[model samples]
Target: MKKFSLFGLKFMFEVKRSSKNDVELYSTSYALREKIIYLILIMFIIAFSSKIGLLSKNNNYSVGDVVISDIYAPKTIVFNDKSAKEKIIENMIAQSGKEYIYSADAGRIYLETFDEFFDDIYALKNNKDSNVDFKNLEKDTGRRIPDTMVKDLLSLKVPEIMKLQKETRKFLENLYESGIIQEKATIKYRSPFDKKIEKLSNLQRQVVETFAAPNYIYDEDKTKKAIEEKVSQINDQYIEIKAGTLVAKKGEILNERRIKILESCGVYSYKKSLGIMMANLTYLFIISTLFYQIIFNRYKKDILRKSTYRSTVLIIIAFFLTFRFINNDLIYLMPADTALFLLVLLTNTKYGLMMISFMLFFLLPIIDYDLIFLVMNIASMTFGAYLIKKVNTRAALIAVGIQMAVLKVATFGLLSFFSEVETFGAALKSGEIIVSGLVSGMIAIALLPYFEKTFNILTLFKLLELGDLSHPLLKKLSMEAPGTFHHSMMVATLSENAAAAVGANAVFARVASYYHDIGKCKRPQFYVENQQNGENPHNRVSPFMSNLIITSHTKDGAEMAKQYQIPREIRNIMYEHQGTTFLAYFYNKAKALDPTVTKEEFRYSGPKPRSKESAIIMLADSIEAAVRSLDEKTPRAIEEMLRKIINSKIEDNQLSEADLTFKEIEIIIHTFVKSLISIHHVRIKYPGQK
Candidate 1:
């Protein structure tokens, strides 16, 4: 029977050990976890890219309608239906040689130079005595020389009048060269393009009513040769089109069909528009990188712990893709603040700044104009993040509301610069943006508890809050079982020191200390600390019952911790702080009475402390309780107590499963003994002290 029992116990022991191993094995499958995150990120990028048509090629064309006219007027003037040509000619005539036009009847006039005018009346005719004043004639003409005449004359576009002037100049030069009029000859015309031929007979110089080729003009043969010669130069000025493709027409609309062809030819369809968007995207990336480096990167681990890169990537992709359906407004929701708050609960200022920067990047392609609003959004998020960073309780939800207000005001201020918009409208948009941030932040806050429960990412800040001395359970322990509470507090001090010395979580140790004795509150009188009236309940109970009561704290504490939704990390410590060990004091007392009491019946069943902090607390609790019994609270007594406790725990195989090394244990023991002796040492008394 004994051999069969031993075999059965060994089998049960193996099963328990295997179960604990399984728990730890699955807790750290880091490689598979990271792969899953990356896969999700890629899927999100693809979805967003497709949504915005970012994967598809697009193009644009510029076109305008032009009219044909033969009047040879400036395009601007023709379009406006203004007589700019006549105005220009009139201005030119004012600055012409005095002899060019004399007395004019409506549009027709006689012309002569200043010298000719002088000679005909004052010099040659010698009518100077007859008041033939040239100055009077010039004043009577009412035409003044203008400063811009030369420029207007050069720019004049009357092709026919220009031809006439050339012909007249040729005729006069020929007349003088052939000695037809030996004296210097001069040609006259109503205007530069309307020359009056003097030597040609009326028949030869007939003014053709219809457009006609001048006799001196080139014939078809010569004209064709001249056209061919100019073709090369003209061709260079025209837009070249390949032989098979149709040339683009002016004012043509680039419909879908045309755009497709253009894209196929490696042409940029949107012309310059794509360049601007790409530039904005690039700028956004730069700004985001800078902001993230400065603000978000510092707290990267903490932020990413909750806001996984996979989720951020997915949200960014979703926001980017939304650009196809809409623009600026939608993109604003994708930035660092939104992503951080949505994906993670920590709304720190650093994260807010990073989120804003990221939002700017996402907004680049979506916000076609007015970048100031994006800046405002960023500022608001930064403020919100700062407000929520230090929130340790659920009331931190107020920070979210405050953040919304900041966003609204900042956004309104930014939008005000561009237009005198209605304050209500600005206020409304601001409110919307703020609300979004708050909603997202609230969601994050709600998830925080679940995340902590599922993942044992116990932060110090959270542990400190959980360990508050005034917490209901701790208060109960203090009031009902003050002895146990005081013992727990001493254990907390020793365990905290030991944990820190071993480079473990001291806060976890301290928190575990408070709740480690919580089970004693159920039967406070049975424990010595709460037996103030000196009625020892254990004296009347069987040794087995006493052991059951003492050991049941682990079970009771575990139940209470679960009921309160205490995190698994804290709960685990409570379960493991005191590994199954013999309660020798009560067991010895029972053994003296019956001499047959089983030691097994006097031991508390345990899970054994799994983590370094829990293990340290267990040792500290035992050592502190043992050292308190010393007649003299000396350094040697404390040191011996610590050594015995540690050695006993090791001998019982309690510390074997823990991660703490021998080196760390040694350090912990030294630090704990020193601290304990310091606390208990007697200070030198004054002169009268005995």
Candidate 2:
């Protein structure tokens, strides 16, 4: 798990155990090969990913955004320029003059009305002694003559009154020639009428205000007729745009007018397609990197046995791809829950969850669902993944699947209630939807065996089955080689304890221990453990011959496991349990006879234990035999013997390729000592037994 950073990203790669030259180090080429394979897988996913959600014929265009490509008129289009036609009619109306009816009678009436008003003032002036009422005189005239004007006129002599009357007649004549706007009896204060009125003295100004009116009528019928004639002269203007004519160019900002034109030409487009594709590219890369960090780093084992990696890749791709075909009604049935359970069983719950977590990011786009469905699946998948972690039987798988089904339904219902999904009842009530969660457990059981067999993996169920003592291989060892069988059982117990203490594969260690010495069954009498008569076969043979016999057992055991169809890891354990260490008994026997005897002549040929399980079993095998051989059975003797044997294996470099750290090795040694002491502990003697 030690990591190094490159740029800003931290990459994870398992550091090598002890020596790079060790025969069992994972080959760099295999690592490279798997990376290439997974990269191709990522590329494949991205290539088809557009179908997942990307749209090439995208229409999410906006005005003012640059065009992606040149838009052309699909067909010839000829249409009227309505705005241009309206402009032409507006100008014609501006140039047309308004018709007005002139009134000569209006002039005479104005003069006579003022003359009468002046005569009233003179009568009031002459009748001052008779107490004449001026209020009555003002109302008789249809004018609001000011009191000053009336008072001035009343004070005027006959000559002044006649002169004011003449001036009023002149003002009326000017208005009659210029004409007033008499529409609604309101005055038109236009140029010519205002010129004469503005030059008036105070007295004449009063006369104009009281007497002036709209002498020029609007003449509505005449104006309406004139506008009709001007509009009739105008015609609809049109223009033709030919097909293939470039309406808009790439990189040009689209206006509303251009957008309408593109839509009419059937060519609206979005430039953001490239951006979407890039986002997808980044998405796939991050997930692939995460898979390498979480799954591959932890589970990368033998190059020859790559089923773990392949199966994970296969299952992930299959589950996400299936989302494409899952109907909305059956979305709850998406084997996401099932896929997750099987993945956890295939690898482990931890990495299985990580892979599924990445897979869920893409679920929304692939299924075209919102976060409600995504959250629902996450809740359901995580529940199923953890729920089935302890499942080891087909029935357990089914039971967990049933639990998952109920949880999926309940999760969907809650999500619907909170999110207010209107179709909750219809989607929930369907038998297919309700049972979707069960597929998590059901499909897992269905696929578990196939993956275990085809991929040569060890799921919990498979390991449990192998742990059964009644297995055919264990039974064969018991019948033909009882003593070796008993020794193997002790070794299995010791190996399991050591492995568990070091966090190695304890179950695999125990199961593999049962068959590690199966080759001894073929030559039961030659091996010390199986010789019930307590005979030493080495006494009957030359030391060289004895070395050959002892050394051949490892190779013979490996072949036996191969024939029994054991997994590659266990087969390796059978082969490597005996490292290339010199056989001291046979070598000493030969050296006593000849001083020149070489150490190589009595060594077992070994590739060495390469994995944690194999290495644990190797240590356990040596420690179990060494401790059991103690004549005094003392705790001090046992402890010293444990360190001696382990030191010898270390000196021989048997554990060099294994991933056991110094601390883990110490823990294994301690665990084996405790377990061995317990097993070999003396029982209390009965009082009368002797």
Candidate 3:
């Protein structure tokens, strides 16, 4: 006996002398499609992610360094008018009776008093210590400025300066919190004047305020003299606010060699953020492929077949592993949202949920997540996928759009719990969230058809369309050979149960059975069950002609299936069932006419049944016909008939070519024989009936 292993089953489809040229090309094309799509989708995902900051650009500078010069201005210094300053000054003067010295000359103010301000400002610069600028009060003011007064003044003015800075700092902080600012803001403030105002520190608020104002009135001669003398004395003094990008100088260039120590830190940070987004997006494509293939394999013929829980889990695992190679390219093509959409469209709710959680990580660089954030994204993606999995319209794509909104809210909510971001970041306003979601939904709707056609994903909706028995072939089967149609249905039930028991695809079994006997439609009256009048067309025909007609059904079925463009897997069962067995009745009659007749002439020329499902259908067809001839269907008689028939086939090696083993055959025979006997079992005879 010629024996082959599981791998050999695939080899039969290869281009060999035995296979049709068309079938070989078709098989090769299908294999190419699988490999090409996966590679293309993966590459697209990585490319897209790189475009969205999910991947970093290697540059000569780091975050605190200037990428471009003169792009940003120094922090501004705005002061309240004299009226506001005078009010505090007058209060200070009235509170303290100490004699106050004043300078009305603005030049003197710049030369003498401005020095103190500059000193204070300079004290703030290059400290890298505390953020405050004012230095030791006792030393600067010679004990005139009390510690309490300095503290109180700085407390008031520092807060005011911070408030003045509120807008600029707000943007910086927003960027930082959102992972936009890769580094903290570097700040500096400096001034050239320092000595003049240092004497006023010990004075009460009234004195300090009175003298601090530049607009105070005084004698004209005295003011002019003070201004001239001070202006001439100090020509070089100036104030400078030096706040901008901080870059490494010549001496710091040596740090480049040591960057490896911090490279992991940067990369880790990068991976945690954008890297995650990259990985997840890449993962999403992988997950989607696994889902599409797994479900495709199971339900390719049925159209409406769903993924099993175990298969779904396998898809998640396969994709997650694929995610390990994720780079910027994956993020560029398929973000978390797009990946989620594809998964939901191809597979089930649970799979979508699983994938969405994985996708959240894909956007990690852009949307840094903690535990809370992770949970929210997972929930949102899962919910979104669940919402649109069964939706058959553009409106359902809106549900996918809601996923983007869900992502925003989910991200926001999580951040609110764990981050200082109270609402959407300044970059992402409430309106923006709505718009993004709506846009995403539109994208999903737009891309769905392309993916379906390109990837050959036969969704449930497509399955529903195919399942309608009103299709031309099914209609012909019903109208022309109603008996065979009924037998096909019964065989479908048996085949589906058997396939399911052995972890095969039940939906494929059922659908394949429906179309299996389509060949009988050409000669409906010749087949026994379809002949309502019990008229035997074969009675007048020679045994050889009768054999020719009977054997033609297999060829006829295969030809019709090809015309219909049925999938190869389904068509395989059609061609292989009945397995070239002898047409016993016709062969015997022919043998009687010619004693030299050979049995080989009567046997079918077959590419024998290759799978368990096809082999079972062949057995069931023969058994169903044989059982009908019984006068009584007792358990003992049924068992004897089933065992004898199966054992004879076993001895004849009819089941040799298929994957089904002897043990499986025993179980199949026992199950089927029991089912048939139970259906036809007779009740005990009543005494008077005879």
* Each model's lDDT: 0.56, 0.72, 0.55
Q: lDDT by residue for model 1 over 568-604, one digit each (tens)? A: 6777777788877778987887888888888777766
Q: What is the C-alpha RMSD of each candidate to the true structure, in Å?
A: 18.9, 16.8, 21.4
Give the runs in model 3 whose Cα sits over 4 Å from its true position. Answer: 1-464, 593-598, 661-663, 681-690
Q: What C-alpha lDDT, on a 0 to 100 scale, does residue 214 get in candidate 3?
A: 28
Per-prediction TM-score to the true structure, in the order listed:
0.47, 0.60, 0.47
Candidate 1 local Cα displacement, residue 666, angstroms: 2.8
- Residue 461 CA displacement from its true place in model 2, Å: 2.3
- lDDT over C-alpha atoms for residue 36 of model 3: 35
Encode model 3's per-residue lDDT on 264-308: one tens digit a residue: 222223444555555656655665566456434543332223232
lDDT for each residue of candidate 2 in 1-690, tens digit (9 for 90 to 100): 778899999999886656555443467655645654573475347434634333444344568888777766644444345657788888878988877776656666756666666666677767854554446535654556677877766677878877777887777767667667766555676767677678887776786777665567778788888899778878765555666688788789987666656555434445554565566667666756665565445544422246766787677667756765544445655556777777788777876776677677755445433566677667766777787766657888778777766776777677766654445343643355456655666777788888888888877778777778897877888999898899999999999988888877778899889888887877878888777667877789998888888888888888877776776767777888887777898899899989898998888788788888888888888888777789877677888998998998999898999888889988987898899889998878878854
Two-way lDDT contest, 1 vs 3, winner: 1
Q: What lDDT would candidate 2 get against the real structure?
A: 0.72
User: Candidate 1's C-alpha lDDT?
Assistant: 0.56
